[model samples]
Target: MTRRILENSKVLITGGAGFIGSNLTETLLNQNNQVTVLDNFSTGKMENLLPFFSRKNFRLIVGDIRDLDRCREAVQGQEYVLHEAALGSVPRSVKDPMTTTAVNVLGFVNMLYAAQKAGVKRFVYAASSSTYGDSVSLPKVEEQIGRPLSPYAITKYTNELYAENFHALYGIDTVGLRYFNVFGRRQDPDGVYAAVIPKFVKSLLEHKSPTINGDGSFSRDFTYVENVVLANQLALLAEAPEAVNQVYNIASGERMTLNELFFCLRDNLAAFDLEIGKVNPVYGPVRAGDIPHSQACIEKAKARLGYAPVFDVRSGLREATKWYFENL
Candidate 1:
């Protein structure tokens, strides 16, 4: 992939104190860009952004995207916007659909309008694999998406719609990234809504048996956080007009079953502590609003934005396990 210098460019990253957002902030700052983070700390942790507080180019605006005034203020004078702030999780959305819609859908539109008004050069936001709801396809393509299975899926799909409309009507360039099961370092593992990888890693490290929600048949295309960061960079810097105003699946183009994921984590964590290998996973009922399988056809992203994922699931798991072992 061609590396574009974003040095000295003013960039705003919503949810910068969260998992993916913090990683993006680190990457952009390494490239010498001026980075500003807008986060509510409702779900985002301040520890993620604390490392950058002393950086001359890093600024933090403690606020929520649900607030339009905060969104407007965050986008002002920013050349690029990476909108990653949203209440994520199927169960959480199911429990509180009203709050989810207000934050994900309403907040997204506010950001779009704010970016438009501020004349931001490019607006890239987090879309989701959940939007591929109920489609029993092996490899999910960008054009074909099924009806949203949950409130979270609907909100993400709505963001795509609003983004496309913003690009067409306001002439603002936009790219939506439909991320698969993204996992990596610093992913929170304490919460009930924690992602599988981090949550399982935490359990295994504690020598506790992590429960699989199904019979271990469920699967997902687990993309690494660095790969997601690469896709964001490509979305922001891609010179092709066709790449803009489009959504791309950011993934490793591979899938892993929960059973396989379990063993992979077990074996990797066991390398650090032999006792962890003996802890077998407990099986449970399948989760509501969960599809049987999910995989992404990333050719659209490759052809359009030159996105090539550097780490596959196994490679990413190896790195992630090492980080969790060290940090947790």
Candidate 2:
């Protein structure tokens, strides 16, 4: 894939005001792409995109994907669509499955239809690690997915199905990236469904004891945000026809227990504040719809999409800790 493909190209990012979306927006804008952000701001914070407001190549359209007409409007004239908008979190989906299905599943179909109608070149979307639910596999492969454990996981899995069907039925190129515990700067730490990393960082920063949902033995392949952005970029620019219409694991290809993650953060953050290393986490019951462990086999992605993760968990954690310490 050449840089010229993204340069001066019109790209639309759904949920552009959110953490991953905002990061992608910044990267694409820096690369001289004309980027349009479509976000409803439900979970996405406006502050995330504040830095890009003045950029001439950046545009923000406050809209929801649940509305088909709005999806059509966002897809128009856009050569590529990076669909990142979704209601994320297992507990949130369990509490409100209807809304989750509406946004993640129905909204996904709306985007696909609109993008197909608009003749968009590629549709790259966010799949989830939760799709490996109940499988108990050490290194998850793309083909061997288990039944979804939560409504959120179900919605993401359904998205892969829809994207594949869209490709088969309509010939619209699609790529699904199964993200594994992505974390970085600008990740929200104050919400009910806040991800573990940011939430832990925030609690430790405030000198509050972070709560571990389980025994801290549950592990994840905590990939960094920049790696995910690279996967999206490569998926958009992939030349091989075999790479299109397939799913790839976007991860660091390593796993760390929650306890290990906690200590790593503490040790890293201790450089800024000596007292941070002393903070201990409170262990609690395991949350529902969570897998015991997760790791990824990235050979498929390496062979197909040329994805080489730039940051491992420890390095990514160091970078993320620095950002949270300074920004939060």
**What's the C-alpha lDDT at position 144 in model 1?**
97
The digit string of per-residue lDDT tens for model 2 on 90-196 reads 99999999999999999999999999999999999999988888887779999998888999999999999999999999999999999999999999999889999
- Candidates' C-alpha lDDT: 0.93, 0.93
Q: What lDDT is reached at residue 66 by model 2?
A: 98
Q: Against the correct fold, how does model 1 do in TM-score?
A: 0.99
Q: Give the distance in Å from residue 226's predicted Cα in candidate 2 to where it truly belongs.
A: 0.6
Cα lDDT of model 1 by residue, 188-239, tens digit: 9999899999989989888889999989999899998989998999899889
Q: How many residue pairs in model 1 have overlapping backbones?
A: 0
- Model 1, C-alpha of 66: deviation from truth (Å): 1.3
C-alpha lDDT of candidate 2 relative to the true structure: 0.93
Question: Cα miss at 207, model 1 (Å)?
Answer: 0.8
